[model samples]
Target: MSTQEERSGRYLDFYRDNIERISENSSPYINSFRQNAIEEFKKLGIPTRKNESYRYTNLDTFFGHPYSSYFMPSEPDFVKAEEFRCDVTDLDAHGVVLINGFYPTITGKLRELPGGIWIGSLSEASRKFSGMIEQHYGRYVNGNSDGLVHLNTALASDGVFLWIPEGVSLGKPIQIVNLVNSDQDIFNQHRNLIIAEKNSDITLIICDHTLSPQKFLTNAVTEIHVGENAHFNIIRVQNEHNNAAKITHTFIHQERNSVATSNNITLHGGLVRNSTHHYLGGVGAECNSFGLYLSDKFQHVDNYVNVDHAFPSCKSNQLFKGVLDDMATGAFNGRIYVHPDAQGTMAYQKNSSILLTDDAKMDTKPQLEIYADDVKCSHGATVGQLDENALFYLRSRGIDKRQARLMLMFGFAHEVLQNINVEALRERMDNLVMQRLKGELSRCASCMVKCV
Candidate 1:
């Protein structure tokens, strides 16, 4: 057999041998889903270059290396986390920390918010909210869709779960910090769920970071449900080490008159792929999606977004931007699908990228499929280098060449950052973008390795 076949066989063997251990902590209902997911994975296998959705990305090379299958839960090292914390930590928010995909029990009382908001472990909540969890746990995610998603569903044992009852608005945001610390190569899977009832509101900040230089893989899935007339805001930041890879999927379902927004910011990683899906299930729902990625060296970043307008009078807007240097690679695919019965739909998408070096690469696809007659939809994409005239103008104004170049690059990336309405979060992103432009983020002593 070939190297690819050999790698596949090894993964199959490991899954078959660890079936029992992987489901040791799972409930019977979830275990059944896991079994079905494993079977699905066996049929689909891993994605190859031949796959249309994965044609630009090559996964076979990464599978050649062996990685640990499991990570045991342990007490988190807060002292170690201080070095990686960002500016958002100072905001007024409830903090939830996870170490290597396991929730850490820290000292303090859980913040009691107005209305009824419960934040805790999904595994612990399974006992009391089993029925509620069962009604929506596997409702949004399809089990047989992708091999990576199936693998995550098969092995995920614990993650965060949040619930907001009707008519309640959270006084502050909820910050989730996932810190990875490992001495050797490892794999981690996390499953998260967020549910908001009618007329409720919430804000969430998810931060993913690596504490060590070890090679690792993270597969995570998050399912969110927004009830009628609710509002939800979420910001995701991925700043892992250069030796790590991450594949994450986010699924959102919006009810009638609901509003939702998601901002995905990728600063550093060796290979990162993010997939976000939004379903507008009711009339007059709206969604706003934004993304920004800065890469250098041999780093690779891919982003895929799919928005489905199933009902009439729905709106969606997507904007994504990227800056690549050296030999970095980046891809953006945005798709908008309007159902035949969905009349009066409005959708817009735009993707723009800047290649700082000749060796840099970028691929973008903005697609719109509209079946309705009275809908307005448009899409566009652009990939090019900085304007030499603009760069020269800054240089002539008594600015150094390096600083001028940085200013031009930041000007290209600031449009996406401006979509963030939160003052604290937007400021944090601005500072990080400036540091990245100046080549200082990875060079700091407390931070991890450089993307290059």
Candidate 2:
């Protein structure tokens, strides 16, 4: 067998050897689909450059490492959890921490807020809220052909679960911090579910960080359901060391008259692939997706987005921007699909990037597939360097070359950053982006490990 095949076989063997243990730790509701998921993973195997969706990235390099999988819940480090603070300063929000993809026990299994809001562990919710879990658990991504998604479904044990009751609005946003800290190379998988009932409003923030220097690979999946007339928003920040590889899949379904927004900011990682699928299943549904990525050195970041308008009178928008320096590489593939019966659809997609060096590369594809005659859709992409005249304008104004370049890059990134509705979070991200452009630490100031 080739080296890639050997690496793939190791996971298959590991799953087979520990199937019993894996099933024993998980609830039957979650275990019911493991067999089928594993079978699908076997048929698809690890994704390679040959896969059309994965053509721009090479997964073999990240999977080739021998890493220990976390199938069972480990003991929670209460001391660490108590002392750890989020990088975003003074943000008044409910905080949830997941260490090595397992929800820490110190925070309790589940928390119920005053407004009928539920936040806690996914495993506990699976058992306690089996009816709700069964109704929406695998609905969005069950038929997906991605092997990595299936592998995560088969191996995932615990993650965050959030529920907002009907007609209620959360007083504060909920922040979920995922930390990977281990002595040895580790592979972790976590599954999250969020439900916003009818007429409810909520906001969520997700932060991914690596606290140890060992090689880490994390495969995370999140499923979100927005009820009719509900509002939901999410912001994700990814910051990890060059030794970490992070893959995330987000599936969102919107009901009639619902509104949902998703923003992703990627700062540092060895390899990062983010796949987002938005399904507008009801009339008057709206979704806005935005992303910004800054990569340098050999870091790689790929973003794939698919938006489906299945009903009439729905609106969708996508704007993704990236800045690549040194030999960094990036990719953005965005698709907007409008159903035949979906008339009066307004969809727009745009991808723009700036390459700072000759070795820095970017591949962007913005596509729109419309079957409806009365719909308006547009897609475009741009990949180039900064404007020389603009840089010279700053130079003529007595600004140094380094500061002028940083100003241009930050201006390019600010378009996406300004879309953030949370003022405090936006300001914090602004500072973080400047630090990253200045070649400072790519990690959060509060984090223990200093990985550039």
Which residues of candidate 2, in runs, are more than 4 Å off?
1-4, 76-78
Question: Residues 336-403, candidate 1, lDDT per residue (tens digit)?
Answer: 99999899999999999999899999988877888999899988899998888998999899998888
Per-residue lDDT of 1-452 in model 2, one digit per residue for the tens?
25656866888887898888877767898998888888888888888888878889987777987787655445645446646788777688998888878777776889998698999889999988888899888787867888999998888878898989899898788899998888889898899999999999998999998888889999999999999999999999998989899999999999999999999999888999999999998999999999999999999999999999999999999999999999999999998999999999999999999999999999887767899999988888999999899999999999999999999999999999998878888999888898988988666556678665
**Model 2 TM-score, 2 decimals:** 0.97
TM-score of 1: 0.93
Point to the candidate with the largest lDDT: 2
Clashes of 2: 0
Q: Give me the displacement of residue 116 in model 2, in angstroms.
A: 0.8
In candidate 1, how many Å is residue 116 off? 1.9
**Alpha-carbon error at 370 in model 2, in Å?**
1.5
RMSD of each: 2.5, 1.5
lDDT of 2 at 371: 96
**Which window of ten consecutive residues has the lowest lDDT sum in model 1?**
443-452
